[model samples]
Target: MKAIVIGAGMGGASAGIALRNFGWQTEIYEAVAQVKPVGAAISIWPNGVKCLNFLGLQRQIKAIGGDMASMAYQDYQSGQILTRFPLRPLVDRVGEFPYPTARAELQSMLLDEFGRGRVFLNKRLIQLEDNGSQVTAGFADGSTATGDLLIGADGTHSMVRRHVLGHDVKRRYAGYVNWNGLVEIDEAIAPANQWTTFVGQGKRVSLMPVAGRRFYYFFDVPLPTGLKQSRDTSRKDLKRYFTGWCAPVQRLIEQLDPMATNRVEIHDIEPFSTLVRGRVALLGDAAHSTTPDIGQGGCAAMEDAVVLSLSLRAHSLGVEDALRRYQESRVERVTSLVLKARKRCDVTHGKDPLATRQWYHSLEHETGEHILNGMAETILGGPL
Candidate 1:
């Protein structure tokens, strides 16, 4: 059987590889005219790394200088540790290793596995049709293709979702904007292979090692009740907003040489009740966007690809049945996760210092077993 996977983002590429692994013909349609990755570091927890390993590309990812270590959560501004979780420890416990790598590196790794012919660029989804025997996709350039299945691995603002599922889900602003900075390699701020977050009143900032030595940073701050990402904003405005956000944050803003960093805003999609709809389905941020608070956006997308392929191939390549299985298997798990991730953002961005402090203290007392169990349960489909 054949499949058309839309978007060509992390989810799409991962799904395409899985489908091909299971003896299914797969084609990826991407809207971008030329595929070049944006953003810096994206985390791949054990749940996702297992998929890469299954696809036989884990070592390739490792070769890209992925960071393998631990993550520390702090009081967003004061840099007080609330919790520190060892990623390698979780890997040992669950038999799944988590690694952090540059987005470009991952895309390259997956693309290498998928090969050139299976993925296409400049192919935007205009519509989707499923008239019993097969599912079909129409692109913006007026090209159309029919396949046994259509996977909406498209990110938020998914066209396949609207055309096939008849559901128009919108991105919900997270009451804040973010600034992304990929800093030069340095000993200060972030050491090699460690992730850190500093949380404080109405703001939070994270420093993660990308490609080992380089730093991938994102700072979150409250957005005016109904602000949208705009070009009208100025550097002075960002500097003013992030004023007094503690040491490194203000300093990071000062060193923001890249133009896009200051304008970055956090947006999430409303969690859906189902990702699979007929022969069409959704994955990645398209299906379950979340505040980047926990850095699971891409990881969950990768999981969807593995699980979807596993289920689809389980039924002798029954595309429709597989999609239904995918939905039944994933919705509850992904939805709960999206909500929990959002709550983390809430606590990190809470305006009340006292309340936020209490939350932080409470989180510190939270046990590693509880965390491991929770993390395991989120993707493993079992109680830890």
Candidate 2:
């Protein structure tokens, strides 16, 4: 089957890889002039890594940043430990691999696997029309292309969703914003694989090492939905927000600097019900956009690609059977994650000081394997 995949991001590239693996001819289109890692660091859970392994990209997975320490947890304001989960014991229990890596590494590896000249740059999809036995994608360049099957991996604000869902689906603001930035891996940081979280009034921060020399931190703060801050805001402003927290946070802000090339992320996100409509399939943030509270945003997108590919490969070419089945397999899992992430955001940013965060942190260790294993069973149960 000739397949046209839109939006050359993680979900789109992954769908292309899966279709190619199934011996289908695939064409990928990206709205961007060039596709690159647009986010900071990303952590791939064990279930998502299983999909990468199925695609034979385990080496790239291993080459990622630091792994979680055997023990991970959240803390209270009283300096008391709350929840602790042993992550090392759950690698295979979860599935295969679960690691946090730089965003560029994952994007670059997928681009390499796609080979050169495969991704058509600057071809923004304008609309899609079903032509009985075939689907046609209309592009802004006034050129049109047809394929036996079309998959829309356009993220968050997907154009494909507007085309297929018949009307515009608005993103629901979860009433908070995320503050994400990276700092040099402090030479003073003694914990090699440790990751930690601290929750305070109306704000929460989670920190982990993305690479040997750099650590990534994202703070979700309860804010007005439509509030906008200057991209040129002084780092001192961010410093003010994070002041008097953990030593690691203070040190991180002291060393971190934002430049034109790097952005200190501050944006709002909401959850979507489902990303698929008719023959057009939505993947990643396009379908389910959850807050980054649980750090499952990117990982959920990676899993979406894997599941969509498997569903298509299991049925006849250009058939709606597979698409319907894809929706069934994904809706519950993706929606569940979306809700879970939002709940985390709410709790983390609540006004309980660090009490709630610490209580959950203590539970993290006990539930780590169970959570990872549950994700594996949910997403990997069907065909790869």
Tens-digit per-residue lDDT, 1-384, candidate 1: 898889778889989998899888899989998887657667776677777888778678667645757777665456566887677666777786667777877888888889867678898777778887899888889999899888887777778667645667767777777766567655456556767777656666777776746777776777765555443454576667766666666666666565655455677877777677677888887788887766678878888888888888777546678788888887887887788888877767774567767866777886566766777766565211
Model 2 lDDT per residue over 1-384, tens place: 788988787777777887888888889988888677766777776767777777778787778756666544444244344455656556645446567777777788887887647888899888798766788998999988788778887877778877766777666666666666666666453255667666556666666776656666666656665545654663655677766666655665566665422433333344455555556777777777676666677777777778777888777754577887888888787877877766655666663546555646546455566554645554453234
lDDT of 1: 0.74
**What TM-score against the true fold does each predicted structure earn?**
0.88, 0.87
Best lDDT goes to which candidate?
A: 1
Model 2 steric clash pairs: 82-362, 83-361, 83-362, 84-362, 84-365, 85-365, 156-286, 185-213
Instruction: Flag clash pairs in model 1.
Output: 75-199, 76-198, 76-199, 76-200, 77-199, 77-200
Clashes of each: 6, 8
Q: Cα miss at 23, model 1 (Å)?
A: 1.1
Q: Give candidate 2 regions above 4 Å deviation.
A: 74-85, 187-190, 260-275, 351-384
Worst 10 residues of 2 by lDDT: 260-269
Error of 2 at 276 (Å): 4.0
